[model samples]
Target: MLWFLTCVAALIGGYFLYGAFIEKVFGIKVDRQTPAHTKTDGVDYVPMSTPKVYLVQLLNIAGVGPIFGPIMGALYGPAAMLWIVLGCVFAGAVHDYFSGMLSVRNGGASVPSITGKYLGNGAKHFMNVFAIVLLLLVGVVFVSAPASMLTNLMNDQFNLGITMTAMVVIIFAYYIIATIVPVDKIIGRFYPLFGGLLIFMSVGLISAIAISSDHSVLGGYEPSQMFTNMNPNDLPLWPALFITIACGAISGFHATQSPLMARCMENEKNGRFVFYGAMIGEGIIALIWCAIALSFFDGMEALQAAVANGGPGNVVYSSAFGLLGTFGGIIAFLGVVILPITSGDTAFRSSRLILAEYFNMEQKTLRNRLLMALPLFVIGGILTQVDFGIIWRYFGFANQTTAVMMLWTATAYLVRHNKLHWITTVPAVFMTSVCITFILNNSQLGFGLPMTLSTITGVVSAVAIAALVIIKSRNSGEVDSEEESLQS
Candidate 1:
């Protein structure tokens, strides 16, 4: 309990202190004309209130990653708390802040465009393809996940006799409409309500956790499980924990989502609140879920076994329904159903925007937006035919790989501007290593090497990448000095 409380407190403090410093480093100013104000296209580039943008951005980056990821992350023990707190403060929020602000500075561009600006056109094209693939996967994963839950919930509680296939078709229809429509029309006006539900669910779960404290709850770190890997699979924490707990910590996927908010923000000052603050908010939610999952089940062994037996979604349903009663049922429905739908819609939308931006295609007209979006959804619909579990296995690595690129791109941006570059550069190296090593260590994914060998190779690869950045920074030239013309 102390650990959980302290982690929460620390995350809050990180917002005002570390979070503010990041905003400062990015040189935010209230008077600058955001792309929303300068380039007002009702479809993709409409101005919105700061608070509203915060919620939309929050809902955009969050999904099952924060919830289920932390649940799985707990398999590595309470050390997941350490990663959530520290990683959220330093890596995740920082990554989000840069991605969002840089997008705003670069004409509200997507990750691939921004990467192209800093990394190069080749890297840009690569990222363009890479990002689209990840988003499609997100679209598919979010679609199947919520649909599966809805089918079960409807059958179990309401006895409505719904099937997973029917649910998928229904939800996929919503994703298509949400993708082609104007942001303010659908996502902007309603995401806050969904965001409110998400916050409410978090609070309810926390209260439930507090009430269940007297049961055979999980205790502090068994000294035996402390530093040596507590992962049930015996994978090292170096990459596995980092990759598993991507949302609360640092994620490349969030960079893709940032441009969505970047196009909607009315002021540069709101960047931290929308991007950095949202990631912190997600970390808290992840921490709460981790604490609950760790305690609600017996020990590590039993928690792992339960997760293996029932799956994360079923566990979420059973545990919440048991703990919070009817309220839990409602919350479970929202968690397992609605939130993922919201995320899927935006994932598809973001992909459309990225491709539209890549082609220098305009999104002012409905026809233009739909023209870009239709084929993507067609591909996504076909992707639904693949087993979702198989799609997710690759999605995780692709997500971290995207993060690695964005971080390096961010470092390059900082260096290009002659600002502090080490902030992103260090984490860039770390996450780069994690992604590379995870593939190398896992046999089906890459070379089936010994864990020790994989770790060394990953670290060496990370260092090489970081060293190249340092050398480039040393040799880099002048900063882009054109500041945004203030409209206010």
Candidate 2:
């Protein structure tokens, strides 16, 4: 309980302390016009209220990553807590804030476009393909995850008497429709309702924990029970824990989603509150799930056995069921079902915007929107039938890998402008190390090298990248100066 409270407090307080510091570093200017005001196409670029935009941003970034990821992360015991609280505050929030602010500065551009502008043309082309694929992957995964849960809950029949297959098709159609429609129409209005349920569910679980002795925090591990690598697969804690808890900490996916709100933000000053603030909010929710999964199941051994038996979704359902009775079960169903559906909606929406930008298609007309969207929905449906486990495994890799690219891009932007480049440089190196080591060491992903060998390779790669950042930092300022001279 002590550990949980302290971490929660730290993440919340960091929003004010560190969030403000990063805002100052980024230099928010109010007099400048935002893309929402400048490019009011009324299709993608639309000005939304600060509160509405913030909630949509929060829901867009979170999804099931915080819930399911932390349950799996808890197999490593309290070590996951350290990553959630600290990684979120220092690495994740910083990554999200700059990515969003940079997007706003660049005319509400998608992340890939922003990367290309700062990093180079080569990086831009890579981002074009990479961002689309990642967004589609996110969309498909969210659809299948929630569809399965809905099937189980409906017992193969719903209030509308539709089968699971029908449910999936209906849900997939919603994704397409949501993508084609205006942002203010679907995403802006209902995301707050979905977001409310998400937060309300977390709070209910927390209250249940406070009132029950059986759900004591840290009860699953004592001082000696802590930090000995509790994973049954013997996966090394270094990279696995970091990747396992990606969304709750820092995610490259957040950068992709940031542009959506970046297009709608009323003021540059709101970036910290919306982008950095949303990431911190996710960290708190993840900390709750991690602590609950750790302590709520009696001990680490019990939690592991349960997870192995039924999977992470089982843990979510069972926890909610145990805590709040019938209402808890309903909340659990929503957590597993509705929340991810909303996330899938935005994921596809991001894909539409990215593709339209990539191909230079105008989205002002419904005809253009449908022309692009039909193929995406078809591909998403085909993907749903493929092995989702395969998609999810690659997603974790693509996700962190995307973060590495964004961080490096941010690092370059800061250096060219002669700001604090270290803000992103340090975290970029760390995540680069994690992604490299995971591929080299994890049996499913990499060559299955020995841990020591993989660690050495990872460290070497990080150092090499650091050296490149320094070199780029030196050249960036000169390039900027020349460009300024030319413009002057």
Candidate 3:
């Protein structure tokens, strides 16, 4: 209980303390004109109030990642909690703030463009394909998961006889509409409502846990089991836990989502509140779910059995219905549905922007938006036909790998300015190690190398990359001159 409360407080405190420090390091300009005003395309680059942007940004990144990822991570015991709190504060929020602000600095450029600007053209080329495919995977994964859930709920409750296929089509159609419309049209207006449902559901769950008669509701903090790797499958704790809990801790996927809001933000000052604050909000949701999962089913053994039976979705359903009752269950169900749909839409939208930026095509006209969006949706629609279970497994690693790249990009940005580069440098190297080690050790992804060899190789590779980046930054040019010029 003490550990749980401390984690919660740390996340909140981290925001005011560390979040402010990051803002100072990035050097926010209150009077600077944002892309929303300078670019003003009416389609994507539209100025929005701080509150609306924050809510939209929150929902955009808050998909099932936090809820589902943390639940899965809970299988690894309280070590998951430590990762979530620390990772969100130090790694995730910083990555998000810089990704968004960098885009703002570069006229709301996509992640690939921003990466290319700092990391060079090779990275830009790689991220072009890498980011789009990742977005497509995110779109498809969110589509299938929610379609299945909505199908079950509707068929069970209203006997609507809605098949998953039909739901997929309906969702795809909505995604198309959401992808092409102006920022203020559907997403901007309705997302606050969706965000409301999400917050309501989270609050209800927290209340249920608080008032429960069971003394074990927050009982995962037993010092004996706090740091233990309690996975039923005996999975190694290092890379797997990090990958499994990406969003609650840190996710590269948020890098893709941040630019959408970056283009919409009216001021640089709001970047911390929207980007860092939203990630913290996600951490809170993840913390709640992880704590509940630890004690909801009597013990770690029972939690394992429940998860094994039906995955995290089952756990989400059981907890909502079991604790919050029928009405709250329905709301929780809608929140679940809203989470992925919101993200999937933005996934497609972000892809459209990426393609537009790649080709130097203007998107002011409907035809241009359609031209960019149609092919991507066609490919996405086709992918819906294939089973994603195997492909989705790679997303965890891919997502973190993207984060590693973004972190390195931010590290380079700080290094170029001759500021304290360690803020992003440490996390960048750490995540680089996690990604390299995970792929090598996991049979499904890489060579299935021995764990010891993989760990040693990952650490060595990360250190080599860090040293290389530092040397390159020193030789690149007069960073001090560039910094002064930018300030002027």
Q: Worst ten-residue run, lDDT, model 1?
A: 479-488
TM-score of every prediction relative to native:
0.95, 0.95, 0.96
List the global CA lDDT of all models. Answer: 0.83, 0.84, 0.88
Best by lDDT: 3
**Clashing residue pairs for model 1:** none
Worst 10 residues of 3 by lDDT: 479-488
Candidate 1 segments exceeding 4 Å error? 213-228, 479-488
**Per-residue accuracy of model 2 over 1-488 as CA lDDT, tens digit each:** 78888899999999999889889888898877788998888888899999899889988888778888999999987878888988998899999998898888887878888787777888889988888888888998898888777766666224555466877887887888899889999999888888778877888887788789777778546676555677766766888898989999989889899999988998998899999999998999899899879867877678888888767777887788788887666865586466678788888888888888888888899999888888888898898888877998888889899998999988888887878888889999899999998999999978999888988899899889878876766676636431221101
- Misplaced by over 4 Å in model 3 are 478-488
Residue 108 lDDT (model 2): 82
TM-score of 3: 0.96
Can you rank all candidates by TM-score, best first?
A: 3, 1, 2
Model 1 Cα lDDT, one tens digit per residue, 233-350: 7766777788888877887889999989998999888888999999999899889878877878777787788788856786677667877787676774575466678889999999
Candidate 1, residue 249: CA error in Å? Answer: 1.1
